[model samples]
Target: MAKNTGKAYEEFVRTIQQSLITAEGMSHLKNIEVETNKKLTDRNGIERQFDVYWEFDLGGYVYKTVIECKDYASSITVEKIDAFIGKTADIPGLRLIYATKTGYQSGASIKAEQHKIDLLIVREADEREWTAEDGTPLIKTIQLNIVALTSPRITSFAPNVDTDWLEKQKDLNADIINHAFTSSLNNEIFISNESTGHKFSLFDLSHLLLKKIPDIQYGKGTFSEELDNSYLETKAGDIKIKIKGYKLDYEYHAPITTSSVIDYSKDLLGIVEKYNTGTKQMIFKDGKIK
Candidate 1:
Protein backbone atom coordinates (compact mmCIF):
# COMPACT_ATOMS: atom_id res chain seq x y z
CA MET A 1 0.00 0.00 0.00
CA ALA A 2 1.08 3.55 -0.64
CA LYS A 3 2.27 5.46 2.41
CA ASN A 4 -0.21 7.88 3.98
CA THR A 5 1.81 10.78 2.66
CA GLY A 6 -0.75 13.51 2.22
CA LYS A 7 -4.28 14.76 1.82
CA ALA A 8 -6.11 16.61 -0.99
CA TYR A 9 -4.01 19.42 -2.45
CA GLU A 10 -6.24 22.35 -1.44
CA GLU A 11 -6.94 21.04 2.05
CA PHE A 12 -3.31 20.15 2.56
CA VAL A 13 -2.10 23.65 1.76
CA ARG A 14 -4.81 25.11 3.98
CA THR A 15 -3.74 22.95 6.88
CA ILE A 16 -0.09 23.93 6.44
CA GLN A 17 -0.88 27.62 6.31
CA GLN A 18 -3.08 27.42 9.39
CA SER A 19 -0.40 25.65 11.39
CA LEU A 20 2.26 28.18 10.38
CA ILE A 21 0.03 31.07 11.38
CA THR A 22 -0.29 29.52 14.81
CA ALA A 23 3.27 28.21 15.08
CA GLU A 24 4.76 31.55 14.07
CA GLY A 25 2.58 33.27 16.66
CA MET A 26 1.09 35.89 14.37
CA SER A 27 -1.76 38.02 15.65
CA HIS A 28 -2.89 39.63 12.38
CA LEU A 29 -3.32 36.52 10.23
CA LYS A 30 -6.73 35.13 9.34
CA ASN A 31 -7.66 31.43 9.12
CA ILE A 32 -6.90 29.74 5.82
CA GLU A 33 -9.94 28.98 3.66
CA VAL A 34 -10.11 26.07 1.21
CA GLU A 35 -12.64 26.51 -1.61
CA THR A 36 -12.07 23.50 -3.86
CA ASN A 37 -15.27 23.51 -5.93
CA LYS A 38 -16.86 26.62 -4.55
CA LYS A 39 -16.73 29.90 -6.47
CA LEU A 40 -16.14 32.99 -4.33
CA THR A 41 -16.41 36.35 -6.05
CA ASP A 42 -13.69 38.89 -5.37
CA ARG A 43 -14.08 42.69 -5.06
CA ASN A 44 -14.38 42.93 -8.87
CA GLY A 45 -17.69 40.99 -8.78
CA ILE A 46 -15.93 38.27 -10.80
CA GLU A 47 -16.35 34.70 -9.63
CA ARG A 48 -12.81 33.45 -8.89
CA GLN A 49 -12.40 30.03 -7.28
CA PHE A 50 -9.19 29.24 -5.40
CA ASP A 51 -7.48 26.18 -4.00
CA VAL A 52 -6.38 27.87 -0.76
CA TYR A 53 -6.32 31.48 0.40
CA TRP A 54 -5.83 33.65 3.48
CA GLU A 55 -5.15 37.24 4.50
CA PHE A 56 -2.87 39.16 6.87
CA ASP A 57 -2.67 42.72 8.13
CA LEU A 58 0.65 44.52 7.91
CA GLY A 59 1.78 48.15 7.57
CA GLY A 60 -1.78 49.28 8.39
CA TYR A 61 -3.01 47.44 5.29
CA VAL A 62 -4.59 44.01 4.79
CA TYR A 63 -2.99 41.85 2.08
CA LYS A 64 -4.99 39.02 0.53
CA THR A 65 -2.90 35.91 -0.28
CA VAL A 66 -3.96 32.96 -2.45
CA ILE A 67 -2.33 29.68 -3.47
CA GLU A 68 -3.08 27.93 -6.78
CA CYS A 69 -2.29 24.31 -5.95
CA LYS A 70 -1.62 21.93 -8.86
CA ASP A 71 -1.49 18.19 -8.03
CA TYR A 72 -0.44 17.03 -11.51
CA ALA A 73 2.26 14.34 -11.39
CA SER A 74 4.24 16.04 -14.24
CA SER A 75 6.03 19.39 -14.09
CA ILE A 76 4.02 22.55 -14.71
CA THR A 77 4.58 24.18 -18.13
CA VAL A 78 4.69 27.71 -19.42
CA GLU A 79 1.10 27.46 -20.65
CA LYS A 80 -0.13 26.77 -17.12
CA ILE A 81 1.77 29.76 -15.71
CA ASP A 82 0.39 32.05 -18.42
CA ALA A 83 -3.15 30.85 -17.76
CA PHE A 84 -2.74 31.56 -14.05
CA ILE A 85 -1.48 35.09 -14.71
CA GLY A 86 -4.48 35.87 -16.92
CA LYS A 87 -6.87 34.34 -14.36
CA THR A 88 -5.53 36.53 -11.50
CA ALA A 89 -4.65 39.70 -13.40
CA ASP A 90 -7.95 41.47 -12.74
CA ILE A 91 -7.61 41.16 -8.96
CA PRO A 92 -5.78 44.18 -7.53
CA GLY A 93 -3.03 43.91 -4.90
CA LEU A 94 -3.41 40.09 -4.78
CA ARG A 95 -0.44 38.03 -3.66
CA LEU A 96 -0.50 35.01 -5.98
CA ILE A 97 1.41 31.81 -5.15
CA TYR A 98 1.60 28.59 -7.23
CA ALA A 99 2.41 25.25 -5.60
CA THR A 100 3.15 21.83 -7.06
CA LYS A 101 4.85 18.57 -6.06
CA THR A 102 6.73 17.68 -9.27
CA GLY A 103 8.13 21.16 -10.09
CA TYR A 104 8.10 23.28 -13.24
CA GLN A 105 9.84 23.65 -16.57
CA SER A 106 12.42 26.34 -17.39
CA GLY A 107 9.88 28.21 -19.57
CA ALA A 108 7.37 28.14 -16.73
CA SER A 109 10.00 29.51 -14.34
CA ILE A 110 10.85 32.39 -16.71
CA LYS A 111 7.19 33.29 -17.15
CA ALA A 112 6.48 33.01 -13.40
CA GLU A 113 9.49 35.20 -12.61
CA GLN A 114 8.44 37.85 -15.12
CA HIS A 115 4.90 37.84 -13.66
CA LYS A 116 6.18 37.65 -10.07
CA ILE A 117 4.06 34.55 -9.32
CA ASP A 118 5.58 32.59 -6.42
CA LEU A 119 6.21 28.91 -7.23
CA LEU A 120 6.73 26.22 -4.60
CA ILE A 121 7.22 22.44 -4.47
CA VAL A 122 5.10 21.17 -1.60
CA ARG A 123 5.16 17.43 -0.93
CA GLU A 124 6.56 14.72 1.34
CA ALA A 125 10.06 15.53 2.62
CA ASP A 126 13.01 13.49 1.39
CA GLU A 127 16.26 12.85 3.28
CA ARG A 128 18.40 14.77 0.80
CA GLU A 129 16.72 18.12 1.53
CA TRP A 130 16.07 17.47 5.24
CA THR A 131 18.96 19.54 6.51
CA ALA A 132 19.63 23.01 7.88
CA GLU A 133 22.10 25.67 6.79
CA ASP A 134 24.48 24.71 9.63
CA GLY A 135 24.80 21.13 8.20
CA THR A 136 22.55 19.81 11.00
CA PRO A 137 20.22 17.06 9.76
CA LEU A 138 16.50 17.54 10.27
CA ILE A 139 14.30 14.78 11.61
CA LYS A 140 10.68 13.95 10.94
CA THR A 141 10.35 12.06 14.22
CA ILE A 142 12.04 12.26 17.64
CA GLN A 143 11.97 10.14 20.78
CA LEU A 144 11.33 11.85 24.11
CA ASN A 145 12.30 10.19 27.41
CA ILE A 146 9.96 10.71 30.35
CA VAL A 147 10.81 10.19 34.01
CA ALA A 148 8.55 10.10 37.10
CA LEU A 149 9.97 10.17 40.60
CA THR A 150 8.62 8.47 43.76
CA SER A 151 10.14 9.59 47.08
CA PRO A 152 11.58 6.90 49.35
CA ARG A 153 9.71 5.96 52.56
CA ILE A 154 10.87 4.75 55.98
CA THR A 155 9.15 1.68 57.46
CA SER A 156 10.96 1.53 60.81
CA PHE A 157 13.38 3.56 62.93
CA ALA A 158 15.15 2.19 66.07
CA PRO A 159 17.75 3.99 68.24
CA ASN A 160 20.57 1.97 69.87
CA VAL A 161 21.03 2.37 73.68
CA ASP A 162 23.52 1.50 76.44
CA THR A 163 22.37 -1.45 78.53
CA ASP A 164 24.46 -0.30 81.55
CA TRP A 165 22.58 3.00 81.80
CA LEU A 166 19.18 1.35 81.16
CA GLU A 167 19.41 -0.58 84.43
CA LYS A 168 19.95 2.66 86.45
CA GLN A 169 16.68 4.27 85.27
CA LYS A 170 13.85 2.89 87.40
CA ASP A 171 11.17 4.71 85.36
CA LEU A 172 12.10 2.83 82.14
CA ASN A 173 9.85 0.01 80.84
CA ALA A 174 10.98 -3.46 79.83
CA ASP A 175 10.57 -2.45 76.13
CA ILE A 176 12.76 0.61 76.00
CA ILE A 177 12.54 1.17 72.20
CA ASN A 178 8.73 1.53 72.27
CA HIS A 179 8.86 4.09 75.07
CA ALA A 180 11.69 6.00 73.41
CA PHE A 181 9.64 7.05 70.32
CA THR A 182 6.95 9.73 70.46
CA SER A 183 4.38 10.83 67.85
CA SER A 184 4.54 14.47 66.88
CA LEU A 185 1.46 16.75 66.57
CA ASN A 186 1.31 15.62 62.90
CA ASN A 187 1.41 12.00 64.10
CA GLU A 188 4.92 11.48 62.69
CA ILE A 189 7.45 9.50 64.76
CA PHE A 190 9.96 11.99 66.28
CA ILE A 191 12.98 11.87 68.59
CA SER A 192 16.01 13.94 69.56
CA ASN A 193 19.54 13.45 70.85
CA GLU A 194 19.94 15.11 74.26
CA SER A 195 23.75 15.23 74.08
CA THR A 196 23.81 17.32 70.84
CA GLY A 197 20.20 18.67 70.87
CA HIS A 198 19.67 17.14 67.42
CA LYS A 199 16.16 16.18 66.31
CA PHE A 200 15.64 12.97 64.33
CA SER A 201 12.43 11.81 62.76
CA LEU A 202 11.08 9.58 59.99
CA PHE A 203 10.71 12.63 57.69
CA ASP A 204 14.30 13.58 58.35
CA LEU A 205 15.46 10.03 57.60
CA SER A 206 13.62 10.01 54.26
CA HIS A 207 15.43 13.23 53.17
CA LEU A 208 18.77 12.02 54.55
CA LEU A 209 18.54 8.70 52.71
CA LEU A 210 17.98 10.49 49.40
CA LYS A 211 21.07 12.64 49.95
CA LYS A 212 23.24 9.53 50.47
CA ILE A 213 22.37 7.93 47.11
CA PRO A 214 23.81 8.91 43.73
CA ASP A 215 20.48 8.43 41.98
CA ILE A 216 16.99 7.42 43.06
CA GLN A 217 16.34 3.68 43.22
CA TYR A 218 15.33 2.10 39.93
CA GLY A 219 12.57 0.01 41.49
CA LYS A 220 11.25 -1.26 44.81
CA GLY A 221 14.39 -1.63 47.01
CA THR A 222 15.54 -1.58 50.62
CA PHE A 223 18.33 0.05 52.65
CA SER A 224 19.72 0.02 56.22
CA GLU A 225 21.98 2.71 57.76
CA GLU A 226 24.06 2.47 60.92
CA LEU A 227 26.14 4.97 62.90
CA ASP A 228 28.73 4.50 65.72
CA ASN A 229 29.50 6.54 68.87
CA SER A 230 26.07 8.20 68.73
CA TYR A 231 23.46 9.10 71.37
CA LEU A 232 19.63 9.32 71.32
CA GLU A 233 17.27 11.24 73.66
CA THR A 234 14.25 9.13 74.57
CA LYS A 235 10.74 10.08 75.73
CA ALA A 236 11.23 7.98 78.92
CA GLY A 237 11.77 10.90 81.34
CA ASP A 238 13.83 12.61 78.62
CA ILE A 239 16.56 10.04 79.21
CA LYS A 240 19.77 10.26 77.13
CA ILE A 241 20.89 6.89 75.80
CA LYS A 242 24.21 5.92 74.13
CA ILE A 243 23.47 4.28 70.80
CA LYS A 244 25.76 1.81 69.01
CA GLY A 245 23.83 2.31 65.73
CA TYR A 246 20.39 2.80 64.10
CA LYS A 247 18.23 0.18 62.37
CA LEU A 248 16.11 1.55 59.52
CA ASP A 249 13.57 -0.57 57.53
CA TYR A 250 13.79 1.49 54.35
CA GLU A 251 12.71 0.83 50.74
CA TYR A 252 13.32 3.49 48.08
CA HIS A 253 10.39 4.29 45.78
CA ALA A 254 11.22 3.42 42.18
CA PRO A 255 11.60 5.98 39.38
CA ILE A 256 9.38 5.10 36.42
CA THR A 257 10.83 5.52 32.89
CA THR A 258 8.77 5.89 29.73
CA SER A 259 9.35 7.13 26.18
CA SER A 260 7.32 8.43 23.26
CA VAL A 261 8.09 9.32 19.65
CA ILE A 262 6.73 12.49 18.06
CA ASP A 263 6.44 12.21 14.31
CA TYR A 264 6.31 15.53 12.47
CA SER A 265 6.47 13.76 9.10
CA LYS A 266 2.72 13.47 9.10
CA ASP A 267 2.24 16.84 10.77
CA LEU A 268 4.48 18.60 8.21
CA LEU A 269 7.22 17.57 5.79
CA GLY A 270 6.74 19.05 2.31
CA ILE A 271 6.41 22.72 1.34
CA VAL A 272 9.60 23.79 3.15
CA GLU A 273 9.03 27.14 1.48
CA LYS A 274 8.62 28.93 -1.84
CA TYR A 275 11.90 28.09 -3.56
CA ASN A 276 11.30 30.04 -6.76
CA THR A 277 11.74 33.86 -7.11
CA GLY A 278 15.06 33.71 -5.20
CA THR A 279 13.28 32.88 -1.94
CA LYS A 280 15.36 31.13 0.73
CA GLN A 281 14.04 27.83 2.23
CA MET A 282 13.53 27.25 5.97
CA ILE A 283 12.03 24.53 8.18
CA PHE A 284 10.90 24.83 11.81
CA LYS A 285 11.43 21.78 14.03
CA ASP A 286 11.79 20.88 17.76
CA GLY A 287 10.95 24.44 18.88
CA LYS A 288 14.23 25.72 17.38
CA ILE A 289 15.82 26.42 14.00
CA LYS A 290 17.76 23.25 13.22
Candidate 2:
Protein backbone atom coordinates (compact mmCIF):
# COMPACT_ATOMS: atom_id res chain seq x y z
CA MET A 1 0.00 0.00 0.00
CA ALA A 2 2.79 2.42 0.86
CA LYS A 3 4.61 1.71 -2.41
CA ASN A 4 1.44 2.26 -4.40
CA THR A 5 0.72 5.48 -2.57
CA GLY A 6 4.21 6.84 -3.27
CA LYS A 7 4.02 5.95 -6.94
CA ALA A 8 0.63 7.58 -7.21
CA TYR A 9 1.96 10.82 -5.77
CA GLU A 10 4.91 10.86 -8.18
CA GLU A 11 2.64 10.44 -11.19
CA PHE A 12 0.26 13.09 -9.92
CA VAL A 13 3.07 15.62 -9.87
CA ARG A 14 4.40 14.66 -13.30
CA THR A 15 0.97 14.85 -14.90
CA ILE A 16 0.15 18.34 -13.63
CA GLN A 17 3.57 19.56 -14.74
CA GLN A 18 2.70 18.59 -18.30
CA SER A 19 -0.44 20.65 -18.16
CA LEU A 20 1.47 23.67 -16.92
CA ILE A 21 3.86 23.76 -19.90
CA THR A 22 1.11 23.89 -22.50
CA ALA A 23 0.70 27.11 -24.50
CA GLU A 24 -2.66 27.78 -22.89
CA GLY A 25 -1.18 27.71 -19.42
CA MET A 26 2.36 28.88 -18.68
CA SER A 27 4.46 31.30 -20.69
CA HIS A 28 8.18 31.51 -21.48
CA LEU A 29 8.35 27.68 -21.63
CA LYS A 30 8.37 25.02 -24.31
CA ASN A 31 9.73 21.52 -25.11
CA ILE A 32 9.60 20.31 -21.54
CA GLU A 33 10.83 16.90 -20.25
CA VAL A 34 9.37 15.61 -16.99
CA GLU A 35 10.07 12.45 -15.03
CA THR A 36 9.57 10.79 -11.65
CA ASN A 37 12.10 9.16 -9.30
CA LYS A 38 15.03 10.63 -11.21
CA LYS A 39 18.49 10.15 -9.76
CA LEU A 40 21.42 12.39 -10.54
CA THR A 41 24.97 12.59 -9.13
CA ASP A 42 25.83 15.68 -7.08
CA ARG A 43 29.09 17.64 -7.11
CA ASN A 44 30.40 15.29 -4.39
CA GLY A 45 29.79 12.28 -6.71
CA ILE A 46 26.98 10.99 -4.46
CA GLU A 47 23.70 10.12 -6.18
CA ARG A 48 20.63 12.06 -5.09
CA GLN A 49 17.07 11.01 -5.82
CA PHE A 50 14.30 13.43 -6.80
CA ASP A 51 10.64 12.72 -6.44
CA VAL A 52 9.96 14.75 -9.60
CA TYR A 53 12.38 16.34 -12.02
CA TRP A 54 11.64 18.40 -15.08
CA GLU A 55 13.49 20.56 -17.56
CA PHE A 56 12.60 22.81 -20.47
CA ASP A 57 14.39 24.61 -23.25
CA LEU A 58 13.62 28.24 -23.97
CA GLY A 59 15.47 30.61 -26.32
CA GLY A 60 18.48 28.32 -26.65
CA TYR A 61 18.84 27.74 -22.91
CA VAL A 62 17.63 24.90 -20.71
CA TYR A 63 16.11 25.37 -17.27
CA LYS A 64 16.28 22.41 -14.90
CA THR A 65 13.84 22.07 -12.02
CA VAL A 66 13.60 19.52 -9.22
CA ILE A 67 10.50 19.04 -7.10
CA GLU A 68 10.44 17.17 -3.80
CA CYS A 69 7.10 15.82 -2.66
CA LYS A 70 6.19 14.82 0.90
CA ASP A 71 2.82 13.09 1.26
CA TYR A 72 2.58 13.67 4.99
CA ALA A 73 -0.76 14.01 6.73
CA SER A 74 0.49 16.97 8.74
CA SER A 75 1.96 20.30 7.75
CA ILE A 76 5.59 20.39 6.67
CA THR A 77 8.10 21.85 9.04
CA VAL A 78 11.05 24.19 8.58
CA GLU A 79 13.40 21.32 9.39
CA LYS A 80 12.20 19.48 6.33
CA ILE A 81 12.79 22.54 4.22
CA ASP A 82 16.31 22.84 5.63
CA ALA A 83 17.03 19.26 4.75
CA PHE A 84 15.75 19.81 1.19
CA ILE A 85 17.91 22.92 0.86
CA GLY A 86 21.00 21.00 1.90
CA LYS A 87 20.10 18.13 -0.40
CA THR A 88 19.99 20.41 -3.44
CA ALA A 89 23.00 22.58 -2.59
CA ASP A 90 25.55 20.30 -4.25
CA ILE A 91 23.30 19.90 -7.31
CA PRO A 92 23.90 23.33 -8.71
CA GLY A 93 21.75 25.25 -11.23
CA LEU A 94 18.47 23.67 -10.15
CA ARG A 95 15.22 25.51 -9.47
CA LEU A 96 13.83 24.11 -6.23
CA ILE A 97 10.14 23.34 -5.65
CA TYR A 98 8.57 21.44 -2.77
CA ALA A 99 5.08 20.01 -2.36
CA THR A 100 3.14 18.42 0.48
CA LYS A 101 -0.28 17.02 1.14
CA THR A 102 -1.24 19.34 3.97
CA GLY A 103 0.64 22.65 4.18
CA TYR A 104 3.67 24.34 5.67
CA GLN A 105 4.40 25.20 9.29
CA SER A 106 4.37 28.81 10.43
CA GLY A 107 8.07 29.52 9.78
CA ALA A 108 8.54 27.02 6.98
CA SER A 109 7.23 29.46 4.38
CA ILE A 110 9.68 32.21 5.36
CA LYS A 111 12.62 29.80 5.34
CA ALA A 112 11.70 28.37 1.95
CA GLU A 113 11.06 31.79 0.46
CA GLN A 114 14.38 33.05 1.79
CA HIS A 115 16.19 30.32 -0.17
CA LYS A 116 14.19 31.06 -3.35
CA ILE A 117 12.34 27.72 -3.09
CA ASP A 118 8.63 27.63 -4.02
CA LEU A 119 6.30 25.80 -1.64
CA LEU A 120 3.03 24.27 -2.72
CA ILE A 121 0.29 22.41 -0.87
CA VAL A 122 -1.03 19.82 -3.27
CA ARG A 123 -4.29 18.14 -2.28
CA GLU A 124 -7.98 17.97 -3.12
CA ALA A 125 -9.69 21.29 -3.42
CA ASP A 126 -12.38 22.08 -0.89
CA GLU A 127 -15.52 24.18 -1.08
CA ARG A 128 -13.87 26.72 1.17
CA GLU A 129 -11.19 27.23 -1.44
CA TRP A 130 -13.88 28.57 -3.80
CA THR A 131 -15.06 31.76 -2.24
CA ALA A 132 -15.45 35.42 -3.04
CA GLU A 133 -13.32 38.14 -1.54
CA ASP A 134 -16.10 38.67 0.97
CA GLY A 135 -15.90 34.99 2.00
CA THR A 136 -19.18 34.04 0.25
CA PRO A 137 -18.75 30.51 -1.09
CA LEU A 138 -19.62 29.94 -4.74
CA ILE A 139 -22.01 27.10 -5.41
CA LYS A 140 -20.86 24.52 -7.93
CA THR A 141 -24.07 22.85 -8.99
CA ILE A 142 -25.14 21.41 -12.33
CA GLN A 143 -28.44 20.09 -13.67
CA LEU A 144 -28.21 17.29 -16.21
CA ASN A 145 -31.01 15.87 -18.36
CA ILE A 146 -30.51 12.30 -19.54
CA VAL A 147 -32.90 11.22 -22.27
CA ALA A 148 -33.09 7.45 -22.70
CA LEU A 149 -33.75 5.79 -26.07
CA THR A 150 -34.83 2.20 -26.54
CA SER A 151 -33.64 -0.11 -29.27
CA PRO A 152 -35.49 0.64 -32.52
CA ARG A 153 -37.37 -2.31 -33.95
CA ILE A 154 -38.34 -2.24 -37.61
CA THR A 155 -41.94 -3.33 -38.00
CA SER A 156 -42.27 -3.54 -41.78
CA PHE A 157 -40.38 -2.56 -44.97
CA ALA A 158 -41.94 -2.02 -48.40
CA PRO A 159 -39.86 -1.19 -51.50
CA ASN A 160 -41.77 0.18 -54.56
CA VAL A 161 -40.47 -1.13 -57.91
CA ASP A 162 -40.53 0.89 -61.13
CA THR A 163 -42.11 -1.62 -63.52
CA ASP A 164 -42.20 0.91 -66.38
CA TRP A 165 -38.43 1.26 -66.29
CA LEU A 166 -38.12 -2.49 -65.96
CA GLU A 167 -40.27 -2.98 -69.06
CA LYS A 168 -37.95 -0.71 -71.08
CA GLN A 169 -34.93 -2.80 -70.21
CA LYS A 170 -35.13 -6.15 -72.05
CA ASP A 171 -32.09 -7.79 -70.44
CA LEU A 172 -33.52 -7.47 -66.85
CA ASN A 173 -35.72 -10.30 -65.52
CA ALA A 174 -39.47 -9.64 -65.48
CA ASP A 175 -39.94 -11.31 -62.07
CA ILE A 176 -37.87 -8.54 -60.42
CA ILE A 177 -40.82 -7.53 -58.24
CA ASN A 178 -40.28 -10.40 -55.82
CA HIS A 179 -36.45 -10.50 -55.76
CA ALA A 180 -35.48 -6.84 -56.35
CA PHE A 181 -35.74 -3.94 -53.88
CA THR A 182 -36.08 -6.27 -50.95
CA SER A 183 -34.85 -5.17 -47.53
CA SER A 184 -31.83 -7.12 -46.29
CA LEU A 185 -31.84 -7.47 -42.51
CA ASN A 186 -28.07 -7.15 -42.39
CA ASN A 187 -28.02 -3.96 -44.54
CA GLU A 188 -25.76 -5.59 -47.16
CA ILE A 189 -27.31 -3.74 -50.17
CA PHE A 190 -27.22 -0.05 -51.07
CA ILE A 191 -30.35 1.65 -52.38
CA SER A 192 -31.13 5.11 -53.62
CA ASN A 193 -34.13 7.37 -54.18
CA GLU A 194 -34.91 7.45 -57.93
CA SER A 195 -36.24 11.04 -57.87
CA THR A 196 -34.05 12.69 -55.22
CA GLY A 197 -30.94 10.57 -55.90
CA HIS A 198 -30.27 10.15 -52.18
CA LYS A 199 -28.40 6.94 -51.36
CA PHE A 200 -29.21 4.92 -48.23
CA SER A 201 -28.29 1.61 -46.70
CA LEU A 202 -30.31 -0.45 -44.29
CA PHE A 203 -27.95 0.58 -41.50
CA ASP A 204 -28.30 4.23 -42.50
CA LEU A 205 -32.07 3.88 -42.50
CA SER A 206 -31.94 2.41 -39.01
CA HIS A 207 -29.86 5.37 -37.83
CA LEU A 208 -32.31 7.76 -39.43
CA LEU A 209 -35.19 6.11 -37.62
CA LEU A 210 -33.30 6.36 -34.36
CA LYS A 211 -32.76 10.06 -34.98
CA LYS A 212 -36.46 10.54 -35.86
CA ILE A 213 -37.75 9.08 -32.62
CA PRO A 214 -40.18 11.75 -31.39
CA ASP A 215 -39.36 13.64 -28.20
CA ILE A 216 -42.11 12.30 -25.97
CA GLN A 217 -42.20 12.82 -22.21
CA TYR A 218 -43.48 9.32 -21.46
CA GLY A 219 -44.85 5.97 -22.81
CA LYS A 220 -44.29 3.81 -25.88
CA GLY A 221 -44.60 5.16 -29.44
CA THR A 222 -44.70 3.96 -33.04
CA PHE A 223 -43.13 5.99 -35.88
CA SER A 224 -41.95 5.72 -39.49
CA GLU A 225 -40.38 7.72 -42.29
CA GLU A 226 -42.08 7.88 -45.69
CA LEU A 227 -39.62 6.93 -48.40
CA ASP A 228 -40.55 7.20 -52.10
CA ASN A 229 -38.91 6.87 -55.53
CA SER A 230 -36.35 4.44 -54.12
CA TYR A 231 -34.38 2.06 -56.30
CA LEU A 232 -32.11 -0.89 -55.59
CA GLU A 233 -29.01 -2.13 -57.47
CA THR A 234 -29.17 -5.81 -58.31
CA LYS A 235 -27.01 -8.38 -60.13
CA ALA A 236 -29.35 -8.16 -63.14
CA GLY A 237 -29.24 -4.34 -63.25
CA ASP A 238 -30.38 -1.23 -61.43
CA ILE A 239 -34.01 -1.69 -60.38
CA LYS A 240 -36.08 1.43 -59.75
CA ILE A 241 -38.29 0.86 -56.73
CA LYS A 242 -40.50 3.21 -54.74
CA ILE A 243 -40.48 2.72 -51.00
CA LYS A 244 -43.73 3.54 -49.22
CA GLY A 245 -41.93 3.93 -45.91
CA TYR A 246 -40.31 2.18 -42.99
CA LYS A 247 -42.59 1.65 -39.97
CA LEU A 248 -40.97 1.29 -36.57
CA ASP A 249 -42.05 0.86 -32.95
CA TYR A 250 -39.92 2.17 -30.09
CA GLU A 251 -40.25 3.21 -26.44
CA TYR A 252 -38.80 6.37 -24.89
CA HIS A 253 -38.69 6.52 -21.14
CA ALA A 254 -39.07 9.87 -19.42
CA PRO A 255 -35.93 11.90 -19.04
CA ILE A 256 -34.01 11.50 -15.81
CA THR A 257 -32.93 14.78 -14.21
CA THR A 258 -30.06 14.98 -11.80
CA SER A 259 -28.94 17.99 -9.83
CA SER A 260 -25.50 17.95 -8.28
CA VAL A 261 -23.09 20.29 -6.59
CA ILE A 262 -19.43 19.47 -7.14
CA ASP A 263 -17.51 18.40 -4.08
CA TYR A 264 -13.91 18.83 -5.17
CA SER A 265 -12.57 17.02 -2.12
CA LYS A 266 -14.39 13.77 -2.96
CA ASP A 267 -15.76 13.86 -6.50
CA LEU A 268 -12.69 14.61 -8.56
CA LEU A 269 -9.91 12.42 -9.89
CA GLY A 270 -7.31 14.14 -7.70
CA ILE A 271 -6.17 17.31 -5.93
CA VAL A 272 -4.90 20.71 -7.11
CA GLU A 273 -2.36 23.18 -5.79
CA LYS A 274 -2.91 26.88 -6.31
CA TYR A 275 0.15 29.06 -6.07
CA ASN A 276 0.07 32.53 -4.65
CA THR A 277 1.01 34.09 -7.99
CA GLY A 278 1.29 31.42 -10.63
CA THR A 279 -0.71 29.27 -13.01
CA LYS A 280 -3.40 27.14 -11.31
CA GLN A 281 -3.49 23.47 -12.17
CA MET A 282 -5.07 20.20 -11.02
CA ILE A 283 -2.95 17.10 -10.43
CA PHE A 284 -4.94 13.94 -11.04
CA LYS A 285 -4.00 10.66 -9.42
CA ASP A 286 -3.86 8.82 -12.71
CA GLY A 287 -1.99 11.72 -14.33
CA LYS A 288 -4.93 12.82 -16.45
CA ILE A 289 -8.59 13.84 -16.23
CA LYS A 290 -9.80 12.88 -19.69
- What is candidate 1's TM-score against the reference? 0.64
The TM-score leader among the candidates is 1
Q: Which regions of candidate 1 deviate over 4 angstroms?
A: 1-7, 22-26, 29-46, 56-62, 129-154, 167-229, 233-240, 246-257, 262-270, 277-290
TM-score of each: 0.64, 0.53
Predicted candidate 1 versus true structure: per-residue lDDT over 222-256, tens digit per residue: 56555554565543336455666666666676668
Clashing pairs in 2: 160-241, 160-242
Count of clashing residue pairs in every prediction: 0, 2
lDDT of 1 at 216: 55
Q: For residue 214, what is the lDDT in candidate 2?
A: 47
